[model samples]
Every structure is written in structure tokens, then in C-alpha cells.
Target: MFGTDTDARNAQQPDKPIICEVIDPTGTPLNVRATPNGEEIVTTLSNGRQVIPYKVSYDEKNRHWILIGDSLHSWGWVYGSYVSCLSA
Candidate 1:
């Protein structure tokens, strides 16, 4: 439904839809954790943590994933409404 017949007729590129670019709130840092429950925090997302955030791997039953500065990582499931795209 996101595309037209031209999309369905051609070889589908599923990778595009699975990726989401995120911009954290300015002046506020975010936490990258080993688990979604906020334990085992891996890294501290500094102010202006501009990067693509991955949560639960786009409905992945196994786990989640996030891309930090070209590094592919994983995360927990986050609802769409809970995330906001900040303006640069």
C-alpha cells in the first residue's frame, strides 16, 4: 500500500522500508542498552545523537537492531508514537 503497481511489478527492495533514521532530542542524551528494559547500558548517546534507531528489528521475532555511526546494533520494541523526529 506504500507504493504503486510499478513497485509490485519490479523486484521489491525490502531493505528500504526496514530502515528508520532517528534524531534524539537536542541537549538530552539517550541510552543504548543491551536489553530493552534499560539494563546493561552499552553507550551513552550524547546530545544530538543523530543516527538511525532500530527497535525490535522491524517485527523481528528474535531480537532488535540499531545502526550507530555505521555500526549495526540491536534494541527493544518501540512504538511509533513514542518516537519523534527532531529538526536539525
Candidate 2:
């Protein structure tokens, strides 16, 4: 059988595009921390830092808090109000 060429493979994954919103009061940073959480122990933007949220989770016990980070102890239960959906 013959094969067909499609540009679909070259298309980017919109579901998890490389984008992160500034949850902190300030979004700019002279430099940002690189952790499993990507921004754990972050500058909170007060120090002027930026980060990309690769992963996010929710917790029932901490309904108002957000579970951030991929490593143990690295996770943070920050207020849901602090974060926003990273735009493309």
C-alpha cells in the first residue's frame, strides 16, 4: 500500500502547549527557579520571577488550595485565587 503525507504530525499539541501564567503579583523575573514544580519555593514574583506550570492538581481536603509540584515536599497548597490559566 502507498502512504499519504500529512502535516498533522508537525502540528503542536494545544492541550499542553508550552505556556505558563504569572500567578504571583508580579510576572517578571531577573531569573526564575527550576524545580520539579517548576516554581516551587518561587520568588512569588515579589523578587520578580516567572515560571511555566507543567502540571497542576486539585485536592478535596484543601478545596481552596492548589496542589503544585511533582516532587515530595515540593508541592504547595496555594490559594486557587492566586493562579490563572496560562494563555497561548
Candidate 3:
């Protein structure tokens, strides 16, 4: 039921497609969270890799998390600190 095209399109998208580079300083892969929190790691996204941002959210702690994924995959949340939005 999730990851539908209409659902993704209807989700809060950016003004434009935002591509970001993973900037994790530890050189380890970044955790892609199922939610906008550290406890729910879904997968690991490598540093220096790019992802398309779909939505942005400010958590209770004031940290911004970006919803990222490609057309071929479902979106996942990543902490904004580890991502640098690049020009399209």
C-alpha cells in the first residue's frame, strides 16, 4: 500500500528536486532511517553518495531531517547534518 507513485507525488516535495551528498565525516556509511529518528535505521547510505530529497522536517530537538530516495525506491529519512544539498 505504501510507496505508490500518487502517494509519493502527493507527499510534501521541495520546490525543485534537491540532490544531496552524504557528508558523514567518519567515512562510514550514513544510516537511512525509517522515521526521522536515530533509533530506526533502515539501511546505510554511503558517504559522498547522492540522494534526492523529497521532504524536510524539523524534529522536536530542532534537527532537520530530509526525506530522500530515488524514483525506483521508497523514501527514507536522513539527518540533515550529514547531507549537503547540491545544485541540480
Per-residue alpha-carbon lDDT of candidate 2 for residues 44-87, written as tens digits (9 for 90 to 100): 33331223344433344422333333323433333333444334
Of candidates 3 and 1, the better by lDDT? 3
- Winning candidate number (lDDT): 3
C-alpha RMSD in Å of predicted model 2 compared with the true structure: 12.9
Q: Over the stretch 49-71, how does candidate 3's per-residue lDDT look in tens digits? A: 88877776667886677788986
Tens digit of per-residue lDDT, candidate 1, span 14-68:
3543323443444455565555533566666554334544323322343233323
By summed lDDT, the worst window of 10 consecutive residues in model 1 runs over: 1-10
For each candidate, the alpha-carbon lDDT, in order, equals 0.37, 0.34, 0.71
Off by over 4 Å in 1: 1-14, 17-27, 53-88
Model 2 TM-score on a 0 to 1 scale: 0.33
Best by TM-score: 3
